[model samples]
Target: MTREKSQSIASQKLQQKVKGPVAQELKEMVPNRKSHQREPRSKDAASNSPVQASVQSIITQIQNGKPNVSGSKETPEDLSFVMSSIFPKETGSVDTSNLKMKPLDYERPDVPRLSFGLERVLFNPGVYHLRDPRSRVYNFDPYLGAIMPVSEFDFDALKAYITSSKDETLAGIARAEKKKYIGSSSSMTSVLSHFHYLLSNWRGVDTRMMSQNFPDHMRSFTRLLRSPAAMFLRYQNGSYAIDADKEFDSANILMNLGKSMEKLLTLPKEDFERYRRTHENKISAEEEQAIPEAYHYSTMGDFLMRSQLDAYDPRLPGTGMFDLKTRAVVSIRMDARNFEHGLGYEIRHVQGGYESYEREYYDMIRAAFLKYSLQVRIGRMDGIFVAFHNIERIFGFQYVSLPEMDQALHGQTDTSLGDAEFRLSIGLWNKILDKVTAKFPKRSIRLHFETRDAQTPFMYIFAEPVTNDEIEYIQTKNQAEIDAYQRRILNLEPKDGNDDLDETPASPEKPAANSQPTAEQNAQPDAQAAYDSSAPPDESFLAELEAEEADLFKGKEIMAMTLVVKNLVNGSPVDRPMVFRADDKWTVEYELSELQGKQVSRLYNACQTRREKALSGRGEDEADAASNVYIRRLRDLAMKGRAYRAKQDDFDSKHGTVVLDEDV
Candidate 1:
């Protein structure tokens, strides 16, 4: 038989095998199909229908190197093109065992908990839907395409297959006629050349160095190359070198951004600071004190900006903790700030800017987290955990202290954390301090708190002790407060010792709602018995527990603290020994001075919007309910220890909700 005849026969057999949507689509595309009547044929279309002619024409064009049909010359996509992608020649023999038709093992919890904490589910594992490769439903980046498996159960085998496929692609490129590649603006070729150049040099050049020193054509070649041999470039011996054995992939690329993408993604800390120092010329004593150093610096991604890649920072903030079982990075950010304080780490907003509560930010953070998690799960990375760390020292100073806060705080008086008289001032302070320490129990969470003056920089390290004197002072203070507070709480409730502190009783008859136990409490050694007053307390045991609280005060006084009293001009840490009393009121004092007017106006407008909506009978909606709750929380906080909202409303109406110029 002729080769063309055999080819036609094979095509017919393939068509028979290709069932479902593609076949249905092909049948639909056929013209003039009837139960009893035959379709009319054209003169040139000897043995073929219009659909067959069109398909044949497209396939011939494709074979003749005209894959991309121009506008004027374009035709409806051939049926076979769609079938070719979905039921590719190699995958024509479907392996039912390997095909993932159900939820994956990772998707199913081994022993599912009733509720996985927000962070645990923050970036829930991406759902692995069995899909035809041609389907546009999956957001397939080149790197993900190179690593993600079609079947979750055969992940290892699939990854190997993908790697091999990439190798074959590279091999094909290598064997292609070099003469045809002259002046070619091929991203794949550009990436390959750079990779080869880097390997030949043996000494790694960062993305920045690559751009600056090499031809401008190679600016963003690193991101495009989804090669298995990509390395984590770091300092080895004395000079920068790629970890050749290290098979860096997408997640690893993000994880090692500090080392690899530093040239492009970040400016050195000293350089950034020097720029700030020079540009500002001189700063106020308050602004000068918050000069940022020893904190992560934000840099404008030159590649991102130039390439117009205005998206999430590919490199995520570390989780600060890793899974011991798998060494996978496991971290969660508790963004109660958005819901509670209306402040947040906005992902879509420019870096080093105020994070507000918006769906964009929420979606950005979650999507990045989920993508990273998926990468790690597929074994493309060593480990990654994108947990929350209140990195105020890094991003905050730039936003607030760059003459902006000075402008905002200008003419403002008595900027202190102890200003309990300010609306929600005290409550806000407690919430921040509480949330920071409470985020990760036993794990160290570094928190920096500054007054408006920015003079007294307060640093707290969770679960670590600072000075004995400081610890002793706080322990004594808290014990006394706990006694008084408990007595007051107990007095308010009936004689049933089970009355809770965090919640109000549902009814007068039922036992009062108990305060929720903190993460630290849940992790405490003998926590239940030690905290329980129903059982007679052992003196020695109580002493030991008291000692534990001194070092690890859950939500009371900060565990490890450093108070800087120096008149420093830069945002560097100053180690000063100072005492913090639990009784002394601490208020939430951020450099909202720059944003005071704007935020105040915005917030008031938001409140008015909620009020308007409520009046219009739209308050029953979820959004209105949330807005009402946010407004009420802010209102309640602002009015704490004050006479009423009337006194503050006038001031709030003018300055803002957060700006308090009054004396304590």
Candidate 2:
């Protein structure tokens, strides 16, 4: 027997054994879980336990691929009763089973995807205006649409709803397991992992009775994980919401957006000329700042209303990510260049400890957040996504030491307004860290930061700095690898030694109305436009021109029908030559070697005689005839190019050599 076959059989036997005794114990524990909570144990203490051993066996089985995961087996429909039986009142008013569920979909090109970091301004204004319409209690009413003002948004109420929904989802899974949701064809190890994750963290979710129904349990568990309830529990925290004054209202945000849009649409020809005359530079300072904000708001509004969800069903909701707890789509950005923005200037680390200093930009950060929060309040934005570029490379993953945080919190400072504001921001951040540590006591802050790093350039920041051990694999790469990573992340090309950086233009998200290209035109590259590194090169790109030329000559047959047309008219004023034009039909019908030797000599002699006669003081009738023949030959050459393109496209598609567009 093959080694793989032997391993598969062994895994099957082990799984069968787990169903015998341990399964019964797991099933019995669920009914009595309310009496007590399991005491936390160190990894060492639990390493040798039977449950752990069983889990290990299940992992092995998955690795062997004895069980399949794609097919689904029906499980119990009502798991909510399990949780409802324990916490009846906490389950809230929302019907967990009826709260329509959908699969998670993240890919959407039109929806602004930003990373968490400094230059967040690129998308922050739009994020500050995002409000979820599916949410029942937050800004949405399910039927009525956005109904509540930002001030009316209650975090506690939102959390309660998701919590209740989660309990019901877990209950459904438990019931499904009891009824045997795991299909006979399902891969045992793959299905078991879902239960293992829940069992490790949550007690009373024993599915041992349904050990035979591993498939069913896995499907239910996956559904629960994709639900809004799971997303809220995983991402929402102290840093999820911006702290702003009670009187602040984000409603003005919409007004600001409207004004910005109006300014863009209302520009006149005379105003353009006046502005141009007033400033010799292409754009004035005010216009530079105003244009992006206008684009941001306009793009945000359109996405909210029409963006499609990342799912099979197109009608549910747009793919704008929402924090169920806060009801906002967090906009993100990464600014690796500098930490000059925001309230970062107040505290600086020197000599392994943080030192306090006052800088002109201290209030700059505070005022920015205040304004941002005000917009968040009005727009109902939930979280801020940011990435500190070069942070991990410069300071390592664990840059913010606990001592530094403490120092920033209590260090002495001048009595200036900026310094005072900085202190307040620091104190709030400290409290946020405390909440994060308490909420996820077992998780390492460093790991969380690393995982977030992996999601950089498009990561959303909850109101706090939370770290987990799950670092993206890319984070481990060295400087050279990082260069490749940056290129991929930004969809940029590697800089060759001879690259000229000066000619590159900034890539604008949206072109002006007059500058907008049609879909057909945009789909094909223009031979006339200058090269744009941000965009894919035109079809006849210079880089590939040589290769195309080589391919044209690759075949043994180089020429088809060699036709030499000579002008037989007398001399004319124009100086012209007998040209060679290869038609598509000629290339298809004849070989290059077939048209060589005698054929070329005969064609060349006829062409010279005709050319001399056509150029001599000729009759108008003869000259016109010669001119028509030249134009017809030129048309035939153009047809050859078109035919080549058509053939190339067919071959690429048939051979699966086409490049797919990524959702950038």
Clashes found in each candidate (C-alpha, N, C closer than 3 A): 18, 44
**Least well predicted 10-residue stretch by lDDT in candidate 1:** 301-310
Judge candidate 1 at residue 328 and give its lDDT: 11
Q: What's the TM for model 1?
A: 0.18
* Highest-scoring model, lDDT: 1
Q: What is the lDDT of candidate 1?
A: 0.24
Residues 138-190, model 2: lDDT tens digits: 22111111122212222111111112112333234324333111111011112
TM-scores for every candidate against the unseen true structure? 0.18, 0.19
Off by over 4 Å in 1: 1-28, 33-354, 357-361, 365-370, 379-384, 388-664
Estimate the overall C-alpha local distance difference test score of candidate 2: 0.22
